[model samples]
Target: MTISAFQDYLNEHRDRLLADLVEACSIPSVSGQMDACEQMAAWVEARLQRLGASVTRWETEGGPPIIWGVLGEGSASILSYSHYDVQPADPLDLWQSPPFEPSVREGKLYARGVSDDKGDLMARIHAVEMYQALHGTLPLVFKFFVEGEEEVGSPHLAPVAQAHADELKSDGCLWEAGEVDEHGRYTMYLGVKGIQYLELRVRGADTDLHSAYAPMVINPAWRLVQALNTIKAPDDRITIDGFMEHVRPPTPAEEALVERIPFDGQALRSRWGLRSWLNDMDDREALRQFVFAPTCTICGLRSGFIDAGTKTVLPSQAFVKLDFRLVPDLTPELVVELLRAHLDRRGFHDIEIVPLSSLSSSKADPESPFVRKVIAVATEVYGHEPVVYPSHGGSGPMYPLASGLGMDSVTVGVGYTGSNLHAPNENIRLEDYFNNVLFLARLLQSYAGA
Candidate 1:
């Protein structure tokens, strides 16, 4: 099918397609809300049904359902991975309108999961309808692997993937979504960093003690701080014993890709109300560090007397939530091993380490044929060359479905720079949403040789 034909079909059904998106986004499928997730999954299943696809609902003991559907007909098959679950629409008062009630203002659609994933998910679904209407049935096998628990680390996805490994086999995968940068350039990511989220705890006396006995009574808060110091230096280096030894430096090709990425550090600093980046790194260095560096961050901390009024007492418990972003060679299990050893070697065995969630790092060959094809089609459809990232700094469950399944994946979505993902006032540009529909349709045509 011609691009204009696709464009005309989109133009004809623009309102209806957008209404479908709004309807999908209307479901408050916040991760962990199984009922809402089921509703959203059913919404997706019905669309697949309309396309005459056979759908399967994979359910486990405690996690949300994994919706799998297959449609189209061709020698080649492609997998599209997305999640109906979204981050909680927290701090509710910050939203101009209700989080689930999608509203359009200033050419942008605002709602809680709109830009993050729902928009991308519906875009792919609508693409099938658009293609089938303009052409006949799709010229390629279209597979949908929409899961319901991505926001909470996708803890169940790994096992679900192994259980249904045969059904997931595909040529390549289109990851959740890509972005349109501030310069109006469409961007794609080949891989994502892995993550290890855990918590550290320390204890002092059995209960709160009067500060007057401070000479003898231990403060767990103070003890926790001392232990945390051993992990990272003031220079921001991860000083955990032997932790840096596991990091794998970027390849020459990856470095070349980073060099092509656009950076505006001053603008960022202005926007964030910061004088400079950590250690005063320049734009290029900051960007490189973002994509290549593994981070040890303290996400949250809780101790005694955090309330407004001061209390002169020592508490018995203290804990801190830690998030470690991993790079190549840094598996979540490996991190746990190294951390346990580090704390033990430092004679801080009393400090407890609680493992929360783990995700393995995954990457694909940027020069792969499937990747090259997607990029070419993106450039053709978006009228701009797509900026290719060798690996995104963010963490995701892409490992289980992409590299874990021996398939390359690319992230090209209906998101933009101001999408406000995982934050209040999340939104997506209507133009980008419509363009994504056209882009996915063309991608199918290119893959199927239609």
Candidate 2:
């Protein structure tokens, strides 16, 4: 199929597609909120049904429904992965308008879930519709594994994936994450880093004490500071033993792909308000660290007060939120065990480590046939060579489809860089959304033939 023909299809049916997406985007499907979660699952199921796919709402014990759909018949199936949930629109006051009320401004749609997985899901569905409209049937068989608990770490996902692994088998899977960079160039992430999140709390006295008693009473804030120091030193290297044992070094091909990734390190640092990365690293080194190296970060720390002024009270309890980015072969359970063991050895066992959530790292061969097909289609439709990466810095459940199912999965979406994902005023460019529909359509057509 010609790119012009696909573009024509998008132009002809753009209004209907946007309307459907707008309706879906209006739902505040924050995964943490159960009601909106179920609503979105049903919405997706209904959309898939309308697209003539046999739909199933796979209910889990405590998680949101996993909407499944199938179309056409082929031994080699394309497993399309996406989520129907979003992060909570906290700090709601920062939003330009209400988070749930979808609004179109300056050729961009503004809402919490607009540019996130919702827009992505709509683009995939629209692509399928475009193919069916052009041809009586899709070029190849496909299925969707849309989950609602992605925002909440997908705790119950592996269980469901394990249970339905046979039925969900496919030649490959394309999990949804986000779209290209700010320049509209096609971007693909083959993998993502694993994560281990925890909260460390230290108890001091039975109750809050005045600062005058500091000499006699122990301060939990100081205790937390000392404990955090043990995990990561001034040089920023994590001190947890065996933390780097399972880390797999990048392959030669992966290294070559990293060199090809055009990242303006200075620009990125400026955008994120960083003076410079640790060790004064250059572009290649910084980029390598971003994709390959593991890290320990202090997300937040809660302790004594200084709000509006200083009311001196030694807080009885202090908590520190921490996250450890793990490389390949580094399981979350292993990282947690190492941290616990280190703390116990260091005599800080009193400091509790409450586990939060974790997502595994994944890496797909950069030159795999499926990956090449994705690149070819993206280049043809977008009129630019796609940016190829061995893995992504962010963590998502992309591992299950690629590493779990042994498929060369890739991620591309309508999401624009600096879309403020998971933050207030999340949105997508109007043109990006339009082009995304054409991209997916061409990809489906090309892959089917491949």
lDDT of each: 0.90, 0.84
lDDT of 2 by residue, 1-450 (tens): 687887888888878888999999889898878898888888899999999999988888988889999997654578888898998898998999898888889998998888778888888898888888887687578888899988778877888888888877777778786477866667888888888898998998888989999998889899888878888877777778777777898999999888888888888889889998887877788899889999889999999885897798988999988888878888889988888898899889789989998888877888788888888878887888888878888888877666877877888788878688989899888898988888888888788773
TM-score of each: 0.95, 0.92
Q: Per-residue lDDT tens digits of candidate 1, residues 1-450?
A: 589998898888889988989999999999988889889888888877877889999886688788889998877999999989999999999999899999999999999999878999889998888888888888889999999888887878999999888889898999987999888999989899999999999988888888887888888898899999999999999998888999999988788888988777898899999998999888899999888899999999998877888899888889999999999889999999999999999888899999998899888787788898998999899887789888898889999999899999999799999999999999999999999999999999998887
The segments of candidate 2 whose C-alpha lies over 4 angstroms from its true place after superposition are 89-101, 208-219, 305-315
The C-alpha stretches of model 1 lying farther than 4 A from their native spots are none
The pairs that clash in candidate 2 are: none
| Cα error, candidate 1, residue 138 (Å) | 2.2
Candidate 2: lDDT over CA atoms? 0.84
Clashes of each: 1, 0
Highest lDDT against the true fold, candidate: 1
Q: In order, what is each prediction's RMSD in angstroms?
A: 1.8, 2.4
